[model samples]
Every structure is written in structure tokens, then in C-alpha cells.
Target: MEKKKLNHYDVAEVIDRFEINKVFDCFTLKNWLAIGTTNKLKPSHSEVLEEARQQLSIKWDEWNEEELKMNFVSMVIFVSQLDVPKHINTYFERKLSGKVNEISISVTVDCMLASPTYSGRPKNPYFFLQEFKRSLGDNHDPEGQMLAAMILSQKLNEDNEPLYGSWIQGRFWYFTTLTNKDYCVSKPFDATEPEDLLQIVYVLRKLKELILARVTP
Candidate 1:
């Protein structure tokens, strides 16, 4: 008999399997703002963002998924300073067991941020970011992807603290948090706006701080 491999599912199918609902009433952007951004955006970062924003407005429809990742997503990583040295990119398959079922969940995230290990290997991801290729369509499900990634990350987290993740579709970004099996998603923030992008940078900076606090003595 052949051995059965772990099942594979896209972000949307996973969301349906888990019965994840869009309970906007449980989401809060005001409390998220209190986390604050101590790492202020530099003038250079602002210029790059403005250029990318303008280009995206015109060319987004023509761009592919990798184009979106490279042009928009990579820029956010750069502006937020979430590169390999500080947080390794183990954007490969992350496998986790499900809580409610006898099944496994996995995803190859667009980006996975985690603390650096001396062994030079990718450690448990604390945060994830996924880019949903189609932005204009109402059917886009970046939130599902975000929540799925967060759920897996939450299981991988040994610290047992809240696991966070975000997803972007076109110029819009949304955030999610998984704490004690309770998931909450935040209202969307447009990356095309300078102020909104700055908040993203700050939130990323805060994430770095949180990682350091957990991993460092």
C-alpha cells in the first residue's frame, strides 16, 4: 500500500476547512496603533515608497505574483529592515499539525520572519506576509492566507505569545493576530498612502522588538 502524504490546500480552502469567519466586530485598529513605531521612516524610504506607489497604481494589473512580491512586498521588507541578517527568510514549506482535526497544515509563505540561529538554519517563524495577486476582485482572500499562516506560526511558537501576520492585495494591507486560538484581523491599510506605509514600518519594527525580547536574554 502507498503511504498517504500530508494534504495540500490553498489559503482559501484551508479557511473554509477551519470555518474561519470574517468577524470584523472582533477586530480593532485603535488598540493596534498603541504598539507604536519607534523606528521612524527615513527620507530615502519615503522617496522609494512614493515611486513604488505611483508605479503600482498604473501597472498593478499588468504585474504577476512575483512582480508584486519583488516590486511591492520586497520594498516593504527593505523599508522595514526585515532582511536575512536580523530575520532569516525560511520562506519554504512550514508544516504544522491541526488542533481540531487529524490533519496537517502547511504553506510556503511569500515571506517568513524569524530570529536568527547560530546554526544558520531557519527557525520558527513569528510573523508572515502574503501577497494576494488579484486586488481589484471582491473574491480575493488574502485574509484567509494570513490567518492560515498565523495559525501555523502560533503552533510553532514555543513562547506561546500571540503570533501575527499580514497580507497585501494590490495597494491594500491587512494584519492578523492569533492568541489562545482566538484570531482577530485588523482593518485594511493602504500601502499607497505614505502615512499608512509608515505605520507598517513601525509595526514591523515593533515585531522585531518582540522577537528580540523573546529570543534574547
Candidate 2:
């Protein structure tokens, strides 16, 4: 079957209704505006993209024990509040065959920002993924974490076909290398404080709106 094209205007409307402007204001949305407005799409997007790529790639190798632990904790705290769509819930119910699995994880596979390459075409700018592991524990294995993500990809595909390519939809990922100590260290998902949680929710809602507007028709 042919895929349905996304409605960008509908998505933009969602963003506007959800106040995405306020949420994105906390991050590099301005930088994106500056880059997007340029006649010749510059390397500004690539620079940030490369940073995230390099960080994830390097982390995949060296494996920071502390960051791994932090990520696990962050995932647990943040995913607890996420609401699942009825269709996804029904799909999982059938897939698991009545198993009492409570955790539902989905990955974001595309980069939030993109720029045309020298050849005048867009390319993989960056990616990121977050998982809600079933049995929460203190285990810290980067390789295992990566593998688990891969497994989840297969399961999701079997359950319901994704919009983009399989890998893109399987991984909830973003890429940015700004390394602004504040944003990186702040750890949006790991926030427990009331104000911090509110901010995180606001940002996520805005991100959803922006994505819907940009990708959907």
C-alpha cells in the first residue's frame, strides 16, 4: 500500500495550539530559524548533527558508566507519564498475546534539524533514541542497551508498520552537538522537580507539534 503523505499545516496548527513556540524557545530553535532562513543551507545544522553523532558514536565505544546509569534512571522517570495511543495499545495487546507487559516504548528516529548537503540534498543530520526497559534495574551495559533497542525495532515492525523506514521509526533519537553545558547537564527527561518536569513536558509537547507540522501534511 502507498504511504500517506503527512499534513504539515495540520501539524503546524497542532504546534500553535500547544504553544510549541514557548517550549522550543528554551533550546536551539532560534539557531534553527537562523539556519533555515539562509538562502544557501549552511553547515550550521551539520555541525550540531555531527556533534550528536560523534558523542553517541564515541559513547558507544568508550562507554561512560555514569552516563549509562543516568540514562536508565532518566528513561524510567520520564516514560512513566507518557500516554500511548489506543491503536498502539491494541497492537501491543495482540502482539504480546495477553502478556501483562505494562511498559510501552517507541523511538524517535529522525534528526530535529536538517540541511542540504553540498550536492543540494538533505542527508541524515543526526538521530537519538530513548527506551523504556521492561524490568527496571541498576544494570549498565551500553552494548546491551543498543541490542535491546534493535530488538524493540523488530517487535514494533511486526506489530505495526512504521511511517518512515523501520530503523528511523524504531529509534527515538535526535542529534545535536551544541554541548551547551546547561542543556546537556540539565537532562530534560531526568527532571523530578515540579518546575523542571513542567518545562520538560512543555518542550516535548512543543516538539511533537513542530514535528507534526514539519512532517505531516
Best candidate, TM-score: 1
Global lDDT of each candidate: 0.65, 0.28
lDDT of 2 by residue, 1-217 (tens): 5432212213233233223221323344333222222222135533433344345334433334335324332332243222222211101101111111232322232112222245533232211222223222344222223222333343433423111111111112221212121111122222323333333334443433443444335
How high is each candidate's TM-score?
Answer: 0.76, 0.25
lDDT of 1 by residue, 50-138 (tens): 78777777777778878877787777777777554655444533443444343455555667777657875566777777755746344
The candidate scoring highest on lDDT is 1
RMSD of each: 4.1, 19.2
- Total residue pair clashes for candidate 1: 0
